[model samples]
Target: MSAERYEYVPHHLLRRRVRDIASGVEGELMAVINENVSDSPLREHWVELAHIRGASGREFTTAAANVVPA
Candidate 1:
């Protein structure tokens, strides 16, 4: 089976208020972590947030695709 393909378009979400679509939670976007694959053309984006409502921790990471401006 072939792997799923993704475009490497990075979003500028730093210090912006964003909401997670899947969880419907909002928070201030703290960081964007990019992982470049050596054998693939796509890069993975992970986002970290601070001051998240209804969350147990102070920060968490989620896929960049799951977040949008709040």
Candidate 2:
């Protein structure tokens, strides 16, 4: 059997304006969460954003691939 491999992509998204392609919501990137699996070579990139909507300044997390510079 062959092992699966994935390429590591670097992202500098902190404090930058980004938009979620799936949700159509734009906000300032607040944090980046990296999740490492012990059994796999894959690393998941999770991003947190602020000021999604309204005056409350809501925040949410989603896959990094869903976000793009706005």
What lDDT score is found at residue 53 in candidate 2?
32
RMSD for all candidates, in order, please. Answer: 7.7, 7.4
Encode model 1's per-residue lDDT on 7-67: one tens digit a residue.
3433576677788787888787766555333454454443332333334437765677787
Instruction: Provide the TM-score for each candidate, comma-separated.
Output: 0.52, 0.54
Model 2's TM-score against the true structure: 0.54
Query: Runs in model 1 with CA error above 4 Å?
Result: 1-10, 35-57
Each candidate's number of clashing pairs is 0, 0
lDDT of 2 by residue, 1-70 (tens): 1242333344686677888787877887766554443453354433332322312488876677687887
Determine the backbone clash count of candidate 1. Answer: 0
